[model samples]
Target: MPEEIIDLNSIVSGRQPINSSETPKEVTFDRVHSILYGNSSTKLIYDNAQKYFTKKFDQTYPHTSLQRDLFISIIQKVHPSLKVQFVVEIGSFTGNSASIMGKVLKESYPGSFLLCIDTWLGDLAMWINKAVWEHLSVSEDGRPTVYYQFLTNIIKQNLTTMVLPASMTSIIGARFLQTYRFYPQVIYLDSAHEQGETLIELSLYWNLLRPGGILFGDDWGWSSVRCDLKKFSYMKNLTIEQAGNTWILKKPVN
Candidate 1:
């Protein structure tokens, strides 16, 4: 029998493709063109992705309806290059909005958090709507249970790390603002679409935002929310833009 000889040069050049029986050599690899999801250009979209990923359990909260599309688009416009540090959200229904915002921040600033405030008690409609009573068996007395379940869902999603839960009116005090050491970069007012409540939410966070920070709300087309936002814009000399069911109020960039 003749002895077989291997061509070493061909093996090194990959001119001779290795068979399945051949073991490949291991070598170190370099990381080129790394992608940061929530970078300056894509932070808002990144946040929307997080919300979509966790949207299944969000049904309990009153859906934003037409406002959802506005949120998706708005998130896109909010370039991550702005480097807004904190986000404050009023009326964190089932925490869906907060979770979405938190996801965006996580991509750019992993340690950032969203402050979520709500009573968790169902809105006034919950007490008056016959549909809620018939479907979810959510009588006025059962609202607390429904609210509890919403928070439970928030926790199960591992959102507690990014969501700071607070009761209604709790975010107004000086202590709450002092905790951040800096003003919030974005403020969302979606608490109550009712006239009084909407006005209050706006008034509360009006001056609390940093000069370049933004304030937006859902149900912008609604009579109550719209009126309040219009007045707010005129009074503050700020411009309010409506996209779908949401309104955006931008504080002048300083």
Candidate 2:
């Protein structure tokens, strides 16, 4: 196996990144409300999200994948097992949502683990939208290297035991799971919002999801995302549901 191939379990056994002793940086909000708010369409969506985050998430910043209550409720009400033991989270930016999820699974679904895969690099929109890029954790070398901070967040939450970090592309992460014969009961897609990329990711990860598993993601407000999900749902004959900014699709149990 190559160095990039992550041993899913071993990653949580210990964090192998540099400066292990360094204090974890506390994540702050984009209080200025920057993150692509310049675009009229996205601004409208962001403002809408701002309202929900303020009400439900305690006035937290709107840059993360949230809705803790919604996620747990779906598992409890919809999923047959009423528990999620395995989760694969694509695009964990600084582990904000993963921390919430890790904590939830730890308390509600004991013995569960979340494999968080990411490139630790901001998406293209971030680079194009300077305000968005400003929020990322950049290395001294000027690279958007948020991976270490992601580990720190996991450690701070005491989730290293249940939150496995895999720093790589979504495709490689899927391959890693396949190599281990790993199958996830839940797959979270938050990586790319581009229609083409989103479709590819949805199709690629669908194979890794167990029957009756849930495939969900954020950014439903983005036209591209909505279009891609609708197209994918039509192609697969899967029914997609949405509540707030999150969307979900369940694989039929044959």
Candidate 3:
């Protein structure tokens, strides 16, 4: 079999190059708010993330911070089965979220996995926004090289045993949805923010959740994300819990 081709340099540079058209005069309101309100621990992580990845962003990716806390909460609150299997994470950015989940999984289930799925590519919207992409390194196929760096960082953090990288996919890829049919105990969805992609992720992954499993999505109240999740509000037997930009959904164990 051919070795999987990866761009090590791109993985280290988590942001794509910014062009003149992409640069802005100053950071946005969200950026300032994030900086002001960020917890000390979160700020430290963000600082290290910027330095480790050499990437800058217009707005703070608070999803990464929230995801970490929520993931830890889930593990501590829910007792795992002796046969603890898998925790699925869609969109592993810099491995922050996965790393946190892995910590709990490592203690609960010696060899259980944190299976992450992402294309790691900056889409047209990402490029057009000219934000994080400017510092991200992408392969010829468009996957970010920072993915490898994320893996390496997690390993150094002692999370290697609990993390697994699955096949990559664009946020809107139907094939990816079909692939998600392999049910997981917990699924964390945080892919693209476009309406179409978010809807597809919800539809496809919702069913792949095993009984008693939980599904959570980031970017809940954000316009692009909120619009899509709102469509499911009227669905029978489904209730969503809102927390900042995170939305939690459960697959009842009936």
Candidate 4:
């Protein structure tokens, strides 16, 4: 059989047809705030980062503005008082999410830093299964230049100082953090969504989060992601919460 063709533009434009019968509710700032804070009275930060990403990069990120607000809220809740904060993001594709979070950190906590970890080469699954190879950046030698794009996006947003890049796999990045004894206040896992890989990441990065910190991931609706998160939460004796397409696991304050 011929290879199945996935429309990159359709997915980016949110025009992709749903393959499942169940339709998730639309994610809004109020909905996300309710789930994360249990109340909607708290105002969320409104930034131009999303619009900047859309206009400059022309890529559709899976994360939304509401989700980004939730992230900032969690960060503020965990580390109230504007101290230096450290955030780790396992997947920093095109720097959209990173840009949003970085902008928040820069404005709220002047000395805060964000560590964006990614292979920076397009995922093999996207290349082989989704046939999105052509959408990725290319070098003179025909290699993917995604890392360059990520760097450029951050620099363009004037976030190079706040958002640092780790051009490596998630496992390697986690190991480097461990070796350095670097504990982050918030860790976002949006890398591998396979059940086993997600489990490994949770196990590996869970201890790296400080007390009262948070560990969250995107793609909560995926079977592999949800199943593994449920199992992981059960094993860790933590309650999992949903905000839009994101699943959050907060470390206890003990």
Best by TM-score: 2
lDDT of each: 0.55, 0.67, 0.57, 0.67
User: What's the CA RMSD of model 3 in angstroms?
Assistant: 16.4
> Which pairs clash in the backbone of model 1?
40-81
Better of 2 and 3 by lDDT: 2
Candidate 3 ranges beyond 4 A from true positions? 1-63, 76-84, 123-125, 129-131, 139-143, 170-181
Compared with the true structure, the alpha-carbon lDDT of candidate 4 equals 0.67
Q: Return the lDDT, model 1, position 229.
A: 75
Regions of candidate 1 where Cα sits further than 4 Å from its true position? 1-62, 66-82, 132-143, 170-175, 178-182
Candidate 4 — which pairs collide? none
Candidate 3 per-residue C-alpha lDDT over 40-86 given as tens digits, one digit per residue, 9 for 90 to 100: 33452323444434432222333364555667665443334314466
- Kindly report the root-mean-square deviation of model 2 from the true structure over all alpha carbons: 14.1
Cα lDDT tens digits, model 2, 36-74, are 134333443223423322212221225885768877865
Model 2 scores a TM of 0.73
TM-score of every candidate: 0.65, 0.73, 0.64, 0.71
RMSD value for candidate 1: 23.0
Task: Please tell me which predicted candidate would have the highest lDDT against the true structure.
Answer: 2
* Candidate 4 deviation (Cα RMSD): 16.5
Worst 10 residues of 1 by lDDT: 27-36
RMSD of every prediction: 23.0, 14.1, 16.4, 16.5
Q: Candidate 4 at residue 15, lDDT?
A: 29
Clashing pairs in 2: none
